[model samples]
Target: MFTEAQLYSPVTRTGDGDVTVHLSTEHPGVHDPAYRARRNAIAACALEYTSGAPTPRIAYTEAEEQVWRTVSIELARKHRGLASAEVLAAARRLALPTDHIPQLDEISAALTPLTGFRYVPAAGLVPLREFFGSFADRIFHSTQYIRHHSAPLYTPEPDAIHEIIGHATQLASPRFAAIYEAAGAAVARLRTDAALKFLADVFWFSLEFGVLREHGEIRCYGAGLLSSYGEIDEFRRAELRPLDVFAMGTGVYDITHYQPILFCAESMSEIEDVIGAFFESMDDETPLRARHLPTHANVPVAQ
Candidate 1:
């Protein structure tokens, strides 16, 4: 499973209103001090935010808005045909701005009524536990910065685009939101770090990068695929395998490149019945007990 630091900028808050980001050198635009400083400032503003407090607003530059616009328009087109029905419906419900970057609060406001999910600011990496555990309360930790202007359609790590467009939209759906909550609860119940890591890996394959077959067509439900301009179209080309918890949890791959393998579900019902049920039933002893159970007993039961 992916770690917060692997996917986000590192955020640190020194005071009530003072937040900073230590951008990784591997990240795009990291060599530009001005750009790095801008990221820090935006994250700082987000740190000052509290529940019910007005969301921190950033005056996005023309370049930043352009990045949002380009990706939003292109991804919208891809989504129309390739995204899961639940995602498309949720995206419509959210009705995110395409001309400019929508403020985090704006997205949260739209999502709250639909699923009670709200966005919180992250300077960079949110601890894995806090990041996933927040789902139990329907809160999502997000970054405020856009991807580098040069690659409006691509980001080395998750940026505002991935957080809002990909995840916020998904959270708008009651079905998906319920699954998220289940996953969070499972995380909280797991006593061993190994179990937690296993759970996170399962989430990685099922929610962050999972795929599904809908009405004879393969569709993307994972945020990582849905928000990606380049990778969304390429996911179908990967080796699509059955959704297996063990393989998903143990498999290792490079994050920097397009995924070469993906887990596919037969349908949305399979996702809920198998993956969702797995989350709802898991605890600290689940994994350990499974290890001792017969192999057939551990396989996904017929839905």
Candidate 2:
């Protein structure tokens, strides 16, 4: 079975600059020729792009627009009750359209004013170093394809929904943007694969899937949970442990399933102090030392 990362990043370019998106048999779009063609067309747009140029635009089909509309309306309803106040405020400021799929350039235009962040197209997997390192420059590499329309609320891989709705809203916040840049800077300072993986794992736990306490509720701040229809409803049921960098950096998780364990912050300030500080100070030796530290005891799972 393909790892979740591999599943999401199935596009590859050949020596001659041709783009091919390999869909696993389990992928919903694998048997659909129309969906496959659309994936190729969208990936080609990213393949043909040059940095600092206008982000490409896609004329989304009515079906595609409907998918976006369905997800946007549903996620908005869930966010009001499950998302962190910081995320809710950022979403309001970003003001993404609920009736149509907003082009990446439009998303960039909004983000640039808020936090100096901009979007660049990715045909698929950007190398780990480049992906994380680009955060230092306020650049986000995003995929442009929507998921197969048959299951609007279920995607086997990260789609445009995950890129724009999941990440763009979080990027709208200055504090979250600062944390992203810090992670990018930490990636630049690291020298080993081990250290990079450690940083990525920490990032996965915190920014991609982190949660925090707000107004007596365990609300979501992580883009992974925020963008996920099912995950938004299920995260509070996961084991909610306190933030522990050592554990977060060294922990193992299966991205394909609802995460069974999560690290929660006492507040947004705690996220900054713990996750932000770790990213700012991390280096090649950090994970080495972290591995030797005793793990924090798990807190009682959220009721």
Candidate 3:
């Protein structure tokens, strides 16, 4: 998966409440003058926004709305059979608009009551510290831009669809929202970059692309897997291993394609007991603790 920062624009806020979001030209879609202007407009609107302030609405183009409808309709069907019950329940609670692109405010209205989580806008890449730390306050920094229209089903970076559809649904559940808050607390307590990176890796594997065994079948609970149209089907074919904290924190893998390896828990209760417990107890010593332990590929924890 892409590094956390690469998926969001870097945002800077001034003491006087002035905000500047610097969009990267690295993505070719951003090269379009019209798209760039739309992105900038949304970022500007976000700058003027404050907590409890009304979310700024973007006037989406017809092309963008069509993209939203296409992905929304297809992902809904795909999610029914593949997504975890937790994700499905949250999706029902959110009741996200399918016929048109939803404004960030609409998402916040649905999510805030359920889990105290709300969305904030980003231009391109949000710094890892601010990005993860915001979770402590139940805030999610998201990009307002849509993916390039040419390929609505795929985006090299996390777009509005990924951020809103994938993450917002996950955030809607109090159970999963608590994990996010715990992860944020973990980041706040860490003193070293390595420790933070380890946390990020753990999050990438578990929250972003994690899976769990439900009954006799393997199902996806991770946002990355839940939102993806293609990879969701391919994930079951990858190497599925038991959930291991050490392996997840230290594992190195390629992001240019579907993950060849994924960690799975026996059930949702196992997810809460094991992964949830890990998040609740982590501290500055976590890195040293992992390093001191034997190099085991996959250590089974009694679930």
Candidate 4:
């Protein structure tokens, strides 16, 4: 699993209450002072947010809007042919705007009626426990910053696009929402870091990058694949394997490239029965027991 630092810019607050988002050297916006300032401003909005208060609003720039518009349109087009039927249906029900970025409150309003899920803002990297544990209450912690404008189709970390488009749509689906809550409950029950890490790895493999066979064609439901403009196009080419909890929980993967391996569920029912049930039943001893299982010896290592 990728560390939080590897997946998001770090946010720091000054003694005077100013916020800064430190982009890595390789981040697309690292050299752009204006973009850096925009990130800092957005991060500050999130930092100031309080629970039960209205979600913060961002007045996105035209460049950011254009990036949202471009990627939204392109991803919508791809979703027709590549996304799972369930995801497509959820997308329709959520009916997110494609012409401009929507605020977190707007997404929450849409989702709450459909699946009782709502959005909360995150400055940057949320602690893993807080992040996953929120799901138990049907809450998702999201970042508000848009990706660097230079690459309309790319982002090195989870931005508003990934949070809203990828996750919000999934949360709109009752089935997916239930799975998320189950995973979160499992996190709450876990006592050991190793077990927590194991659960997270299972979630990474299933919810973040999972796939399934629909109408004899492999279709993706994972948010990581659903939101990625490039990775979505390349996932079908990866090695496909049957859904196996032991394999998924212990498997190693790299986050910097298109996933080289994917787990496929026979149907959404299988996902609920296998992944959902696993999350609901897993505990601190689960990973320890998993390691002793014979199947653990065969967990695949990414090539």
Residue 77 of model 1, lDDT score: 98
Measured with C-alpha atoms, the lDDT of residue 247 in candidate 4 is 77
Number of backbone collisions per candidate, in order? 2, 0, 5, 0
- Ranking, lDDT, top scorer first: 4, 2, 1, 3
Question: lDDT tens digits, residues 65-109, model 3?
Answer: 998999989999989998888889999998999999888878888
Displacement of the residue 271 alpha carbon in candidate 1, Å: 0.5
1 or 2, greater by lDDT? 2
TM-score of each: 0.91, 0.96, 0.88, 0.96
- Position 67, candidate 1: lDDT: 93
Candidate 2, residues 132-227, lDDT tens digits: the string is 999999999999999899999999888899999999999999999999999999989988988888888888898989999987889999989988
For residues 55-78, could you state the per-residue lDDT of candidate 1 as single tens digits? Answer: 777899998999999999999999
- Give the distance in Å from residue 277's predicted Cα in candidate 1 to where it truly belongs: 0.8
Per-residue lDDT for 90 in model 3?
Answer: 91
TM-score (C-alpha) between model 1 and the true structure: 0.91
Q: What are the runs in model 3 whose C-alpha is more than 4 Å off? A: 8-31, 48-52, 294-303
Better of 3 and 4 by lDDT: 4
- Estimate the overall C-alpha local distance difference test score of candidate 1: 0.83
The residue-by-residue lDDT of candidate 4 on 1-303, one tens digit each, is 535568988899999999999998999999999999999999999999999888889999999999999999999999999999999999999999999999999999999999999999999999888899999999999999999989989999999999998999899999999999999999899887878778888888889999998988999999999999999999888888877887788788888888988988889999999899999999998876766665522343232
